[model samples]
Target: MNKPDPIPARLAALKTTPTHDLKKQWRDLFDSEPPPFNRRYLESRLAYRIQELTYGGLKRETVRRLERLGEELDGGDRKKSRVRADRDRPTTGTRLLREWQGVEQVVTVTADGFEWQGRPYRSLSAIARAITGTRWNGWVFFGLKNHRRGA
Candidate 1:
């Protein structure tokens, strides 16, 4: 019978090893300089790399299936075209502050929408309406999009 791999034991020991020693081990295992990630991230990725080396990586068929699923979910070409549009928008947890009628209003970006006055709104327009009692384009109201005429 083949001898059992020693990677598991080394992975367990990695947790207790000092950062400097871990960096040296990482260099040996990966044959490259260690990244600037934290100790936990380094340990976890190292453990994964050790296991992958001992028991081979995912099969080509599995990788192809994952790519197919990703393309289907993202709608392929449609998703690629929208990438630039999505990049122009603010990310979640961003805070937007605006002053209207001598009162300061604060809105926070969320994963699914925006939050204002401790309430969730599906769009910035809804939050702006609640704040100003008038209809408004949310992206323009929040200064997220330009409203100037084309030169």
Candidate 2:
């Protein structure tokens, strides 16, 4: 029996063909069951051949063709190319107090707490007391109130 020509010979024959055409031929070659020794050796060598051809060129068309060939080699599934977003994406939260019902009606007090118009000064009492010397009366006052020596 005669020895068959190697895959390198076959790949060399394909060099002059268009990239897509070469990929199709290669796919056909891979699909066919070569002899046992030929199968293992050809698979590894063909992969290296592809990578060599891909990175050897600077042309955009060459790069695109290489990418296409890579896609076909990995089972021709476009879904595999998709990437999931990382969990660290920034997020914002709403603060109820930041948006008061009627901000104009709300008062700032020497004693901490908000005083809303038509509503008694009942919220943020501790905040007002901690910030101001006296109790808040729902009026938006900025200046410090005089604290008596004993009150």
Candidate 3:
């Protein structure tokens, strides 16, 4: 008789596990403190960790291929991407719409920054300035938080 597969059982158990236990498992498996995120995030990461420990991680070729794909969008510049992440900028093709005073404002996200009224803006603050004629926190004006979700 073949031995029963334990991975499925292990994965199933994660759904019912307490958040604290999941955090501990994350610490044990990752050897680091669990990030401050919601329970869903913890469960998913823990599930991946369990599977990774059982079946080895992705092959080097797959990792390299993914990196190349990311480079196509990130321009292979780690520093610039890191800064963009800090700013919590939206991805390309995102449209931000807001109504101020009596006019509807529209901003389209681009790799460099944003475009509004056929003008390229280096920052959201610039767009906000053009719309309101006053200094404002661009993210706040655009109804977005300064930080992204704990992704």
Candidate 4:
């Protein structure tokens, strides 16, 4: 006969377990204090930990493969990866249009700069200044900075 699976029962118990017991379980499993999270979060993470402890976690080869992919994606530099992922520049050939003083201004993104009024400009801040006659942040003026993936 096949052995019965205990993972389901253990996971189900997480829902019925007292909050203090869940915190103690978390400390025992993770070897650290429980994070200041809601009960649901605590229960879910405890369930995962219980399952992992019983059945084991990811294989060494899978972890190595993931690390290799991460290195290729970010050149193995965590800071550079963060900076690159946060950059919000639009792709080349994108056209940005804005209305200023009842006149429409158009700007085109190029491989190396931006084009406006048939002239190439080095920076978007310069373009915003040319349009408004005052200093303005190009990304904010163009309404793109506020749309970041994670604020």
lDDT scores in order: 0.79, 0.41, 0.83, 0.82
Model 4 residue 34 lDDT score: 85
User: Cα lDDT of model 3 overall?
Assistant: 0.83
Q: Which regions of candidate 4 fall more than 4 Å away from where they truly are?
A: 1-3, 78-151
Q: Candidate 1 on 8-126: residue-level lDDT in tens?
A: 78889988999999898789889999865456668887888888888888899999998888778666566674674456557889999999889999998777667788767767887
Off by over 4 Å in 3: 88-151
Clash list (residue pairs), candidate 3: none
Clashing pairs in 1: none
Error of 3 at 11 (Å): 0.9
Q: For model 2, what is the C-alpha lDDT against the true structure?
A: 0.41
lDDT of 2 by residue, 75-97 (tens): 55655443111111111221113
Candidate RMSDs in Å, in order, are: 12.4, 29.4, 12.8, 16.1
| Least accurate 10 contiguous residues by lDDT in model 3 | 142-151
TM-score of each: 0.45, 0.19, 0.57, 0.48
lDDT of 4 by residue, 1-151 (tens): 9999978988998888999999999999999998765577688889888888999988999999998999999888898986764455577899998888899889998776788888777678888998898999887788766646635
Tens-digit lDDT track for model 3 on 67-144? Answer: 998899788898988886756777798999999998889999877668888766767887898788999888889988
